[model samples]
Structures are given as structure tokens and as C-alpha cells.
Target chain A: MKELIVLSGKGGTGKTTIVAALAALMPDKVMADCDVDAADLHLVLNPQIRESHRFLSGIKAKVDEDACNSCGKCLKACHFKAIRIKRTARIDELACEGCGVCIHICPTKAISAKENDCGAWHISDTSYGRIVHAQLDIGEENSGKLVSLVKMQVRKQAEAQKARYILIDGPPGIGCPVIASLSGTTLALMVTEPTMSGLHDLKRIAGLTAHFKIPFCVCINKYDLNPEISGQIETWCREQHANLLGKIPFDPLVVESLVAGKSISEYDSPASDAISAIWQKLQLAFKE
Target chain B: MQIAIASGKGGTGKTTVAISLALVADKPVRLMDCDVEEPNCHLFLRPDHMESQTMYVTVPEIDLAKCDFCGKCRDICAFKAISVFGKNIMTFPELCHSCMGCFLVCPNEAIKEGKREIGVISQGSINEIETLSGTLRVGEAMSPPLIKKLRDMTSDAMLTIIDAPPGTSCPVIAATKGADFTILVTESTPFGLNDLKLAAKLMEKLGQKFGIVINKAGIGDGSVEKWCAETGYPLLLSIPFDRKLAEAYSNGIPIIKAAPELIPAFKRLLEEVTQ
Candidate 1:
């Protein structure tokens, strides 16, 4: 099966809008939203959850006050500064990395590591196909782990259904979560706009994809907003030997459709036409 | 006082609001770009005479000569960054959380402290406003450590503005936590409202005082403003959707620079938040 992941180094560049459009266009595909921290694909697809599961990934350290000796060793050993001297030693859950170093250093064995429930994942049925998405709890860490879980679940669903494609909606930035979504994907479609920030971030993410030896293509969203920068982007794409997919014009209907909980493909607009053309080219790339 | 301009969704004008606020502040301010993965503040601020410093994160370096295959280090690691197979032992620097668990657990004292170059922190200034930013090395998985390093480098300016990375996860928390107040920038769309709720929930959990700024206000619906009213999160400012502003932003120009009339609004915003 071919896996296509949509990524944008900069956020709010219409990555979800494009992914949702592809979900409407592609017939045999399972969708996964790897933007676990700020998942938005579901806002358009409106998936009905089939199965829900709690994600228990890392551990958090807790200090038992009764067993604690006020030696302050645990406080001093914590690199995260999670441990503080409160009448006895106290561990701040937010600051704790679950490293268990305090547990090892405690003279009285007061500190213990317990598994943390970082978030929840769900398998759902969308009009397009099966989808796997997740929500990382507020103020929680280990978002990359939750993203991997979602990807693995969606891949399994795709294999079971014998689907031809798995379209993933990736989070913004070139950090841990983005890496988790991009690793080992068949193709990556980077959605960017015509702004300097967009071009700057596009270069950074392209460097990341190239570092992993992953073949990627670029598509400029709202190219009409700045035609000059759009031309500049196309020239850069050509110089870098990167595939320049079709560009979508600035259409207000894109937002109207989103507000009405529909994909641009389901609506009539120039952006919709551009996206359909991009989908056709993507299918060709998948076959190659 | 320190103010962090953040958004759960990307491209919601966090950097634009951050630079504008810093420029309009009455006193000297320090603008910190904590979005290490893809920092964009430098694109607009254009600080002069940039001074750079390499940032590093700690990882365990095992001494093979003194090492025995006890597997203690591997077992204690929560991130599973280290593995012991028969006579072989390996450490994946990318997976390591730098908790120093292996260094503490090694019975033979074989684990030594090592450093990995993750990114660079640079300092420069635009007149009275000093600028600081962190740029992560490409392919680096972690960003919180670099963000933390940048926060630690904050000077004692009367007003400090942080342009936090997009998302409500670790990096966002690292940049936003401990600030006096946070300004959550978002648009007026379904996706924007959804992510803004998540970001607002995070701030509440952290017990951070925060307000909202609705950007691109005229394009989408009024749900964002309605939600703010219902949740009692003060709606501080609204930047209407304008082609001229969009064109200016496309060319790496700050909003205040593009439209000088917005300066008074930003000044009032600074006053309101600082009060």
C-alpha cells in the first residue's frame, strides 16, 4: 500500500483543508491525523468513533511523603527541577520527565515511578473510510509517542481493509511529532503559502525530509495572495529538483465550506479545481 | 513582566502579534522566539549584529572498557534510548530524554555524561528591543530543551515577549509556562476555534492568566468570539482580514509597519495585559 502524508512546516497553511479534500477524492484509503496535539482533520471529516483506547506511554515520578527523609538528595538530583522541598520532598508532575533518577537517588526509597495516561486514541468510521486519530491531554508530554500509536493503528486498519492508500495529516514544525509522522512514508506532500515565513519554513522541512531520504513535493496554497513570492517558490522548487504540484488560488469559499463542515472538494470553487488536479498528479506519483 | 504569544494552530499570527507588541511597548522589551524548530521572528524583526551560541543537551556516553552487560542502564531508561543485547550495548541519542537515569544506574560507573548539539541560540537587537531566538538543528526530534535554554537566557527586561511554537504540547508548555500572562492568537474558523479551545484548556490547567486575540476576524464565522465570551476569556483585540495586511505579511513586513494605525491598538493591548 502507498502511504501519503500531508505536512506543513508552518501551521494554518491549509494542511487539513487539503487532507480533507483528498479524503473526499480518494476512494480506497484509511485516514490518520498525526497532529495529535492540535488535531483538526476530524473537524471536517466528522468521524464517528468506533473504538477508543487510553494511551499509557511514559511514567511520572511521585514522592511518598511518609517514606521520605528530608535529606534533599532527590531535590538536588532532579535535572528537571521537579522535586522541591515542601515540608518533605515533593514532585511537580508537570516538570517531571519521569526519568526515575529521583527514585534511584532517594535514600529512603520515597520516590516511585508510575505509568502516566498521556492521552486517548480512537478508531472511527468516516464517509471516506476508516480513520485513526488521537488527543493528547492538556499539559501532557510525549506527543510523539501518541502520534506513532495513531499511525500504527491506521496502518493496521489499512492493511486489514486492503486499502490502496493511507492519507495522514501531520502536525506543524520539524520536531518529534513531525518526525514520527514522516518516517517511512511513501510520499510527503508539503503544503505551503506564498509568504516569506512559508518559504522559510518550507526550506527547513524540506531539509528534514531530505535528511531522511524521503521523496517530497511542494504545493503552494493561496498562491494568488502573493504572486511574486509564488513565482519565487516555483523557481526554488525547480532549482532543488523538487516536484512543483499545482497551486490553489485564494478562495473565500474554502473557509465557508469549513464553517459548514465540508471539504473544498464537496464545494464549488477554484481551490476545489486546483486540489482535484493535484490529486490526479499525486496518484501518478504513487504509481511511480 | 513576561508575555507569551501562542496559538494551538499554526499560522494564526503569533509571530506577527509578538513583533508588533514588542515594537509598540513603552519601555525596552526583550522578544524571544521560542519556536526553535522553525523560528520566523528573525524574518521580520531583522535584528542587527547577531551573536550566536551553540546549545547542547546531555546524553549518556558508555565506556566500553569499564562496561559490563548488566542491562541496568537499559532497564532504568524510561525512553528506551539504550538497549543491551548479549555483549553489545547501544545508545540512541535521538530517543534519549537526558534524564541521567543511566548515569545514575550504571553499577560500574561506565556511563559518562555526553553532549549533543541540538540547536543554536542567537541574541541581537532592534533599537531598544533585544531579540533572542533558537533554531533547532534539522532532523532533531526534541525541542523543549532548546526552548528551555532560550528561556533561561532571558535578560531582566521590564517587558519580555515570547513567541511560542504552535501546538499545546511540551514545547508550547515549555515556552509559555511561568509567564505573567499569555496571549492566545487564533483566527475565526472551525479549525481555529477547535485548537484555541485546546490551547485555552492547557493554559487553565497550568493556571496561567491569558486572553485572546482574534486574527483574520472577518473571513470566518463568529464562533471564536462567542466561545471566548462563554468561557469568560477576555477577547483583547481583533485584526480584521485585509488584502493589504496579507500582502504586507507576505513580504516579511510587520503588521504595525504595514499599517501604522494598529500601533495604538497594540499599545493598548500591552497596557491591558501588563496591568
Candidate 2:
């Protein structure tokens, strides 16, 4: 199966909206939303969850007050500065890296490491196709791990159903979560806008994809908002030899469709026509 | 007071709002761009006399000379950044969280601290306003450490404005944790309201006193304002949707410069928040 992941180095550039549109256009595909931290694809897809699983990754250290000996060894050993010493040592859960170094150094064995339920993932059925998505707990770490888990679930569903394509909606930023979603994907579709921030972020994320030797293609969203910047982006794409798939015009109906909890493809507007054309170009790019 | 401008959704005017506040503040202000992954504040501010310093994080480097491969260091590593097979030991610096567990667990002192360059922190000034920003090296996964370092470098100005990355995760938390107050910027849309609720919950968890600002206000519906009213999170300001402002933003011009009439409004925002 061919795996296509959509990424935007900058936020709110319509990554989820495009992914939902692709889901409406593509057939025999399994979708996965790897933006675990601020997952919004489920808000538009309206999936009926078929399976829910707890995601347990990484550990957090807890101090046993009764067993504490008031020794400050754990305090000095922690590089994260998570331990505070007073009458007894206390650990800051948010600051703790869950490294278990404190557990090893504690003379009285007062510190113990326990796995945290960082989030949950679900396999669900949608009107478009089967999808796998997750929600990371508020202010929780290990989002990269949660993304990898969701991708794993997507692969399993794809293999079982013998699907032809796997569409992934990725998170913003060129961070751990984005990297996890890009690994081993067939092609990366970079969704960007025509703004100074968009061009700046596009360069950074393009550098990241190049560092990993990942082939990628670019598409400009709301291209009409700034035609000059759009021209600049097209020039940059040509100079970098990065494929420019197509551009989507600014459409107020896009937001209207989002408010209605539907993809742009569900509406008869310019943005929907643009996305359909981009899908055709994407399919051809995937085969190369 | 330190004020952080953050939004759960991306491109909702965090950097724009941050730069506007810094420019309009009457007092000496320092703008800290904590969105290390893709910092855009510098593009608009264009600070002069930029000086940069390399930022590094500590990772474990195995000393082959002091080698007794007992696999003890590999066993204690929580991130699995190290592995041992017979006499060969491997270290993946990218995977390392630098928790120092491997160093503490090594029986033979084989593990030594090594530095990996993660990013660069730059300092400069715009007229009277000082600016600091961290630019994470491409492909670097860890941003919180770099963000923390940037936050620590801020000088004691009368006002400090931090521009945070988009999300409700560790990076966002690291940026806004110690701020006196946070301004959550959002558009008046369903997606905006959804992510705003998540960001608001995060602020509550962090015990941060926060208010909201609605950008592109005229385009989307009024769900955000209604929610803020029902939830009692102070609605600070609403920047109406204007093609002129969007064009200025696309051209790397500050919002205040595009709409000079809005300067007094920003000044009032700074006063109201700090008061």
C-alpha cells in the first residue's frame, strides 16, 4: 500500500481540512491522524470508534513519603531539577523526565517509577473509510510515542483490509511528532500558505525532510490571499526542485464547511474543485 | 511582568500579537520568541546587531578505553538511546533525553557526558526593545530544553512578551509555565473554539491566569465570544478581519504598522493585563 502523510511546519494552514478532503476523494484507504497533541481531524471526520486502547508509555517517578530518609541524593542526581528537598524530598511531576535515576540513587528506595497513561487511541469507522486517531492527555509528554502507536494501528488495519492507500494527517512544527509521522512514508505532502511566516517555516521543514532524505511535494493553500508570496513560493519550489502540486484559492465556504463538520469536498465551491485537482496530481506523484 | 502570547491553533496571530504588544509598550520591553521550532518574530522585528550563540544538550558518550561492557548503562536508559551487543555498544544521541540515568548506572565509568548542538540562541534589539529568540536546528526533536534556555536569558525589562508555539503539549507548557499571565489568541471558528478549550484547560492545569484575544474576528462565527462569556475567561480584544492586515502580515510588516489606529488598543491591552 502507498502511504501519504500531510504535514505543515506552521499551524492552521489547513492540513486537517485537506486530509479530510482527500479522505472523501480516495477509495479503499485507511486514515490516521498523527497530530496527537491537538487532534482536530476527528472533529471533522466524525468517526464512530470501534476499538479504544489505553496508551501507556514512559514512566513518572513518585516519592514514597513513609520510606523517605530525608537524603538529598535524588535532588542532586536529577538533571531536570525535578526534586525539591525540605523535611522530605518531593518530586515535581511536570518537571520529572521519568528517567528513574532518582530511583537508583535513593538509599531508602523511597522513589519508584511507574508507567503513566499518557493518552488513548481509537480505531473507528467513518463515512469515508476506517480511521485511527488518538488524544494525548492535557500537558502530557511522549506525544511522539503516541503518534508512532497510531501509525502502527493504521498499518495493521491497512494490511488486514488490504487497503490501497494510507492517508495520515500530521501535527504542526518540525518536532519529534512530525518526524515520527514522516518516517517510511511513501510521499510527504507539505501544506503551506503564502505568507512570510509560511515561507520561513516551509524552508525549515523542507530542510528537515531533506536531512532525513525524504522526498516531498508542496501545495500552497489560500494562494490568492498573497499572490506575490505565492509567486515567490513557486519560484523557490522550482529552484529547490521540489514538486509544486497545485494551489487552493481562498474560500469562505471552506470555513462554512468546517462549521458544518464536513470536508471541503462535500461542498460545491472553488476550494473543493482545487482540492480535487490536487488529488489527481497527488496520485500521479505517488506513483513516481 | 512576563506575558506569553500563545494559541492552540497555528497561524492564529500569536507572533503578530506579540510583536504589536512589544512595539506599543511604553516601558522597556523584551520579546522572547519561544517558538524555537519555527520562530517568525525575527522576520517582522528585523532586530539589529544580531549576535548568536550555539546551544547544546548533554548526551552520553561511551569511552572505549574504560570499557567493561556489562550492559548496565543500557539497562537503565529509559529512552533506549543506548544498546549493547557483545563488545559493541551504540549510542543514539537523537533519542537521548539526557536524564543522566546511564551515567549514574555505569559500573566502570564508561559513560561520559557529551554535548550535542541542538540549536542557536540569538540576541538583538529593535530601537528600544530588546529581542531574544531560539532557532532549533532542523531535525532536532527536543525543543523544550532550548526553550527553557531562551526563557532564562530574558533580561529584567518592565515588560517581557513571550511568543509560544502552537499546541497544548510539552513545548507550549515549557514556554508559558512561569509567565505571570498568558494571552490565548484564537479565531472565531469551530476549530478555533475546540483548540482554544484545550489550551484553556492546559492553562487551568498549569494554574496560569489567562485571557483570550479573537483574531480574524469578522470572518468566522461568534462561538468563541459566547464560550468566553459562558466560561468567564476575559475577552481582551477582537482584531477584525481585514485583507489589508493579512497582506501586511504576508509581507513581513507588523500589525501596528499596517493599522496605526490599533496601537492605542495594544497599549491599553498591555496596561490592562499588567494591571
Candidate 3:
């Protein structure tokens, strides 16, 4: 099985739009939305959840007031400032990093660790094929762990269905969750736009995928927006020896499809033809 | 007063609104691009950086000479970054949360703090507005610590506009916390509204007062404005969808400079934001 991840260093650069378009062209693939922090692929693909598993990866700190000896040791030991000195020691759950310093430093052992429901992972069936996605609870951390879970589910579902491709729609930013999505992927297609911020973000994410020795291709969305920068990006891609995939033009249908809960490839628009042409090239890349 | 401009979705013009607000402000303003993972405000603002500092997180370093075969440090570590096996111990610096628990509990004092360069903080100025942006090193896992370090370099400007990173996560929370008010910039689209709910819920959870700014207002349905009215959340400003505005932004021109008429609107946003 091969894993193809769609990543854009900048968010809303049409990563999901590209993924959905690719899904339309490749129907037998298993889809995984690894942008757990701000998952929006479901809005486009319309996945009906089949199974969901509660994610319990880390711990949250809890204080037992009865066992507390107001020595303030736990308060002083916490690096996250999760502890506050109320009449009883109050553990600010939101601020806790699940580091267990408070649990270890309490003289009376007033603090303990408890499993936190970080989020939930779903194995859903989309119009394209099987999809594995997740939703992170508000104000909760550990998105990297949740992403790993979603990827694992994709692999399992792919094996059960005997699918050859596992396509991942990744999150923005080169942070923990993005790193988790990069692991074990066969190829990465970075979607970017023709703007300075787009170029700036592309440089960072490109550097990252190269650091992991992952071969990547660049596809500029809305290349018509700034052809000057688009030309500059093309030059940069050539210098980096990265594959320059076909550019998709700026089309209003991309947004219309998103509003209609559909992919650009499904709509009768100019973007559909461009994206379809890009899909043919990706198919050759997948075979290689 | 510190006003933060954030968006749940990226490229919804958080930096667009932020720079425009800073440029039209009558008083001296500070524009802080706290989106260290992808600091793009500098691209638009063209700030002259006066100082640059490498920000570091102090991770635990094990001195095996003073170490016994005890697992106390490993047992106390909440992040599971340390492990003790027989007479050997291992530390994974990336996984460490830098909570200092192992240092406090190490009986043999084997654990020492060591620094790792995570990102860089640069101090610059865009005309009268002082600007600071934190750029995270490529492949770094965490961003909240670097954001904390960036906010520590705050100027005493009467108006501080922080352009927070997209998403309602730790890095974003770290940026939007303690602000006088936050302005959420979003487009009027399905994806925008979906993510806006998460950002709104986050601000409510943080107990920080915030309003909404709808960019590209004419492109999609009016559900965003309708939602704001239903929820009684203040709709601070709306920038009409204009290809010219987007093209100007792509060329790195501030909106106020590109569309001079919007100066009055941003100035009004500044007044309403501070009120």
C-alpha cells in the first residue's frame, strides 16, 4: 500500500479541495483527514461515520483536597502554572501539560493522574471510499497523537478493503500534527498559492519534508492570482529539484463546490478540468 | 490596549485586517505576529528588524556520572521523555515538556537543564508601529513555548494588534490569552463558519471578550452574519469581497493602502475594538 499526503504549510490553500478532487479520480482509496485540530475535509466529501473510538492518549492532573498539606510544593514545581492556591489547591486543567510534576512533587501525594478524553477518531464511509477522520475537543492538546490514530485507522481500513492508496488531507503549519502526518507516507504533494506568504510558508514546509527524506511535488493553486510570484515559485521548485505538478487556476467553482458539499472535480467548471489533468499526472507518480 | 486579530481558518485575512488596523490607528500601535509556525505579517508589513534573538527551551540533560540506576526521574516525568533501563537511562528531548519535574525529584541530581533553540524572535518596526514576529525552526513540534517568549518581548504601545495563528489550539490560545479583546477575521463560507464556531467557543472558554470580522463578505451565504446576530456577538467590521483587494494582498500591499476608502472602516474598527 502507498500513502499520499496532501499538505500545505499555509491553511486554506486548497489542500482539502485537492484531496477531494483526487478522491473523485481515485475512488478505491482510503481517505484520512489528519488535520485533527481544524478538520474540514468532511464538509467537502460528506463522510458518514461508521465507527468512532474515544481517544485517551494522555493524562490530566487532578488534586485531592483532603490529602493536601498546603505546603505549596506542587504549586512551585509546576512549570505550566496549572496549579493555583485557592482555599484548596486548584489544578487548572486547561493549563496542565500532563507532565505529572504536581503528582510527583506533592508532599502529601494530593495530586494524581487521570486519563483525558483528548478527542475521538472515526472510521467513516464517504462517497469516494472509506475514510478515517477525527475531531479534537476544544481547548485540548495532543493533536499529534490523534493524527497518528487516524493514520493507523486508515492503514487498517485500507488493508481490509484491499485498497492500494491511502490519501491524507493534512493540517496547516509545520507543527506536531503535521509531523505525525508525514511519517510513513510514500509521497507528499504540497499545495501552495502564488503569494509571498504562500511562498514563505512553502519554503518552511518544503524544508521539513526534505529533512525527512520524503520526495515531494509542488502544485500551485490560484497561480493566475500572481503570475510573477508563480514564476518565481516555479524557478524555486526547479532549483530545489522538486517535481512541479500542473497548476490549477483560480476558479470560483472551487468555492461553489465547497459550499455545495462537493469537490471541484464533481462540478462542471474550469477548475474541474485543471484538477482532472493534475490527477492524471498524480496517477503516473503513484505508479512510479 | 492589546487587540488580537485571529482566524480559525488560515488565509482568511487575519494579517490583512491586523496590518490595516495598525496602519490606520491614530495612536502608536504594536503589531505582533504570534503565528510563529508561519509568520506572514512581516511579508506584508516590511518591518525593519532591529534585534533578533534565538529563543530556547531548557530541556533536561542527564549527567550519568552522578546517576544511580534509580528510576525516580523517569517515574516523575509526565511526558515520558525519560526512561531508565538497568544502569542506562535515555532522554528524548523532543518529547520533553520541560516541566522540571525530573530535576526536582532526582535524588542524585543527575538531571540538569539544557537549552534547545526552538525558534527566533525578531524586534522590528513598521513606521510608528513596533513589530515583533516569532519564527519557529523547521521541524519543531511545539509552538506555545516560543509564543510565550515572543509575548514576553511586548512593547508598551497603547494599541497592540496580535495576529494569532490559525486554529483553536495551544499556540493560538497562547497568543490570544490576556488580550483586551480579540477580533476574529473569517470569510463568509461554510468552512469559515465551521471553524469560526470553534474559535468563538475557545474565546468564550478563555473568558476573553471577542467580536467577528467578516472578510470576503459577498462571496458566500450570509450565515456568518446571521449567526453573529443570533448569538448576540458583536460584528465589528466587514470587508466586501473584491478581487482587487485579493490581488493587492497577493502583491503585499496593505488593504488600507490598496483600497483607500476602507481607511474610514478600519479606523472605525479600531475605535469599536477599543471601546
Candidate lDDT scores, in order, read 0.92, 0.92, 0.88
Clashing pairs in 3: A99-B78
Per-residue lDDT tens digits for candidate 1, residues B1-275, read: 89999999999999999999999987578999999999999999899989999988999998999999899999988788999999999999888888888887788999888889999999998888899999999999999999999998766647899999999988998999899999999999999999999999999888999999999889899999999888788999999898989999999999889999999999999999999
Quote the positional error of residue B262 for candidate 1 in Å.
0.7
Expressed as tens digits, the lDDT of each residue in A101-194 for candidate 2 is: 9999999999998888888999999999999999999888898989989999899999999999999999999998998888888889999999
Top DockQ: which candidate number?
1
Off by over 4 Å in 3: none
Among residues 3 or more apart in sequence or in different chains, the pairs in candidate 1 whose N, CA or C atoms overlap within 3 Å are A11-B10
**How does chain B score by TM in each prediction?**
0.97, 0.98, 0.97
- Candidate 1, CAPRI quality class derived from DockQ: high
What does candidate 2 score on TM? 0.98
Q: Give the TM-score of candidate 1.
A: 0.98
TM-score to true structure, per model: 0.98, 0.98, 0.98
TM-score of chain A of 2: 0.98
What total of clashing residue pairs does each candidate reach? 1, 0, 1
Separate DockQ for every predicted complex: 0.89, 0.86, 0.82
Give residue A138's error in model 3 in angstroms: 0.4
Give a tens-digit lDDT track for model 1, residues A1-288: 999999989998999999999999998999999999999999899999999999998789887889987899888788897888989998778888888888888889888889898899999998888899999998788888898888899889999999999999999999999999987899999999999999999999999999999999999999999999999999999999999888999998999999999988998789999999999999888887
**Order of quality (DockQ):** 1, 2, 3
